[model samples]
Target chain A: MDQRSIADVTVLSPTGRIDLDTTPPLQDCLLPLTQVASAKVVVDFAGVSYISSSGLRALMLGAKAARAAQGRLVVCCLNPAVAEIFRISRFHLVVEVQNDLAAALAALSSSAAAAYRHG
Target chain B: MTGKPIHMPRLRLVGQAAEIGPAVDTVRRFALAAGLPPESCDALALAVDEAVSNILRHAYDAPVDSAVTIDAAADGEGIEVVLADRGRPFSPLDRSPPRLEGGAADRPVGGLGIHLMRTLVDRIDYRREGDVNRLTLSKYRTAALAAGAPRGEDGADDTGA
Candidate 1:
């Protein structure tokens, strides 16, 4: 997993499978970040080939925290398998999901969008 | 449906969350060797993962002390995975489906495990025999066959992979 900041948007790129045993690191990276007030976060699943419902559970908790804090949480770049899982779970209803990282940043705020463009 | 499972060894492990990955991996390999497509193999593997996770979470108080057994068999049609645990008589299919109609705030997080198991595999059956809780998850080659087949009634013939 790699964490980076683009403008105000915190992007977390997690690789490999996110199942029962591997979800804690993802939760650790996301939960506290989403808890911050007005936080803008993007989870990139481009490198993640698979994610079980356990991973979705973690993201749901993060989404709740982000909503409570009046922040934004978006996930982007899902591979085919992961995308299928998301579709089955209907996770897009709970948290914003974008096909492009740029779109995710744009949905966060105009400033983050511009920052992504500038870089 | 009467296809005898290929001769693969059944696995018994401590009913701990950590046992999920290895068990799923074994099933994935077994499915692939049975000629299931890559995506089908992965999907079947996910169902196994969720089932074991449910057993670890809901079935046992001391997961390390209890045992979860897994077996996989595949024939020309598809694959079936059997997971049995000695914990309480927990029937996951009996739980209400996750309400996916609403947004995150009102959405429930806890129920997706069973829901995913339902969606990932073609069919899931839970039965309690004697003191054992037995859950069977099946993924059909017909599902993979249907994936590339023309869309029609035949495509929905069996459980999807």
Candidate 2:
């Protein structure tokens, strides 16, 4: 897993399968970001070939924490298989999922701008 | 219905979470070979992975090495996967489904695996014969066997989830 910051948005790139064996690292990477107030987080699943319910749980935990902190968690670049799982689990309804990394960044930026303008 | 049995290669793996990858690969290959679409194959793989993971986590009391057997057979209607484990008897279907309507924070972390299994597959059955706990998950071929064989009446109580 790799974590980088782009335009102040925390982007997490996790590779391989995110099942029971691999979710802890992802949780570790995202949960801390959620604690930061107004944190903008985007998870890139481009390299992730598969994900199970455990992975979904980890994402949910991050999303919930971020929401509580008035931040945002966005997921993007899902392979078709992972996207199918997301659709089946109705994860798209809970978390904001973008098509790719660029789109996700744009989403976060626009949302941040909106918050700033409104504030 | 062809009235002929479809045979699929059986996959045997150690009861460990790490072992779920190879098992899912085997299921994906088998599903594709059986002419299932990629979407169906993905769903089957996910369901199988969840089942195996559940067994690895909840079935055993101690870290005794045991094998989980998975058999996939195309029943001219869809695909049926039987996962048999010798660990403690537990019925995944008996677990309550997660509440999916709530907010992300309010959503329970666990129980979603069982819920996914229930939604992804058309039917599931569980039986404890002696020491083996057998779980059969079936995904119907919506296009191929639309009006063919009747669903398996295993009478496995799927109360919900």
Candidate 3:
């Protein structure tokens, strides 16, 4: 469970079980970055099969921080099971969610490029 | 020394992993009887399935001749689920938060269970006592001690992969 930066976007691709045991590692990876860079973060859930409330809180925190930095948080590529979760929680209202990784990256890249061009 | 049995709803099953589906069905019934809405029942089943999946992968490690016990209960207040296993102590909530808005390439792999748990249930408290690991999940139908859960029935079935 790690996150990598691509161009101006950060992709989080997680596998295995995302329960109480594995969530801390993901949290540790994001906390510092939210404190540093204000770049767009897009979590790709294509590979993730499951998620829990603790995991959702972490995402909320990161997205909140990114927004504070004038950046945005977007999630994409959700497996059916995981996608059902986002739908139930209505997370789309707060954070943008996409169907595929390409869409997520394209949206983030274009948004950032637009920001750069304007500001 | 045999310890006294913990009096909670228990379902014991052996054999193939698919058997877990029926077990979840039983748990869903219990939830319905306990006053949980239809939608919540479905959500509880999903949570139970995820927990059992972990037991299948980490505890018994597949095709093992051991029984998985799922304990559930409700005290006219909220729903609680306790999944116990003798496998190694693994806490899914100990990981860092993912970069939900980070670049696709920078996002790490593996580690979304805790997030799911956090998002699905109102509160999930985990503990490892002696040789047993106990994960306690609580959800309320009315007032919650923490955050507000998504609005819906208790046993809403969702079709998904």
How accurate locally, in lDDT, is each candidate? 0.83, 0.82, 0.64
Ranking by lDDT: 1, 2, 3
Worst 10 residues of 3 chain B by lDDT: B152-161
lDDT of 2 by residue, B1-161 (tens): 23465767777777667788888988888888887888888888899999998888888887766668999888567788999999998887677667777568667667889888877777778888789999998877784553353333334744232
TM-score of each: 0.88, 0.87, 0.50
RMSD of 1: 4.8
TM-score of chain A of each: 0.95, 0.90, 0.83
Worst 10 residues of 2 chain A by lDDT: A110-119
* Cα distance off (Å), candidate 3, residue B8: 6.9
lDDT of 2 by residue, A86-117 (tens): 87777886799999877788888965434434
Candidate 1 Cα lDDT to native? 0.83
Stronger candidate by DockQ (2 vs 3): 2
List candidate 3 stretches off by more than 4 Å.
Answer: A1-83, A87-119, B1-9, B13-15, B60-63, B102-106, B143-161
Off by over 4 Å in 2: A110-119, B143-154, B157-161
